[model samples]
Target: MWKMELKLTDKLAIERTRLANERTFLAYFRSAIVFLSSGFAIIKLEMLREVIWIGYALIVIGPILFFIGLFRMLYVKKRIKKSYQNDPD
Candidate 1:
């Protein structure tokens, strides 16, 4: 239960934080997709045979980046909820 009522500014600030979090997650997701796509493209293209290692590295890094973003987003979301719930102001 909320200990105290929230003012209009407080509510707006919280909403802004949530929106920002979503935007950040989207950015991470977009980057992951780009990396994954580039990795696959490089691997499939015969002209880029010399730097195949880079393609493999990118493939591995893409999922890691996705998971990192996922965890960070969830952690921040939970923290925000807990903070507002417990705080009196």
Candidate 2:
């Protein structure tokens, strides 16, 4: 009975960790979309002819956000794997 409970708990923990990782990635994706959309809108609409640099900056930032998110997701996954190996219930 104790072993069964431990197995269930470990499964829950792994699932929770996966969900958290997914949520974090989604958050980053959302931010990238917002930045990319705003940049495209600014450029297409010519919203700020005098300060076009801002639009360019945002466009650059969008990809950076994506890469950062990807890196973070990989890092977290690795950490989780290590932890699981060290103390798997």
Candidate 3:
């Protein structure tokens, strides 16, 4: 296996990129949790009986959002790894 030698700046930049990716993933996870919780709340609460469909929609969307986020994070991480491995610098 070939390894790339990274400069301090390049290493720092990559670290930042990784952190940013993690933050984005966390945001997505948070949103998914919120949606799922809200959906459950709406479904269980007696007051929101009329809008049950909205609850179901949110429930469906929550997992989709989570998977999308997971996929994106993995894709970006893969791209970053690829770039670094192929780096000529």
Top lDDT hit: 3
Q: Which residue window of length 10 is worst by lDDT in model 3?
A: 80-89
In order of listing, the candidates' clash counts read 0, 0, 0
For candidate 2, lDDT tens digit of each residue in 1-83? 13223476787888799789989998999999999988887887755887777778899999999999999999998888766
RMSD of each: 2.7, 4.1, 3.1
Reference-based lDDT, each prediction: 0.89, 0.83, 0.91
- Return the candidate ranking by TM-score, descending: 1, 3, 2
lDDT of 2 at 51: 75
Poorest stretch of ten by lDDT in candidate 1: 80-89
Which pairs in model 2 have colliding backbones?
none
Question: Candidate 1, 27: how far from true, in Å?
Answer: 0.6
Checking candidate 3 for backbone clashes, the offending pairs are none
Question: Over the full model, what C-alpha lDDT does candidate 1 score relative to the true structure?
Answer: 0.89
What tens-digit string does per-residue lDDT give for candidate 1 at 9-34?
Answer: 98889989988999999999999999
Any runs in candidate 3 off by more than 4 Å, and if so which?
1-4, 86-89
lDDT of 3 by residue, 1-89 (tens): 86668788988898899899999999999999999999999999999999999999999999999999999999999998877875553
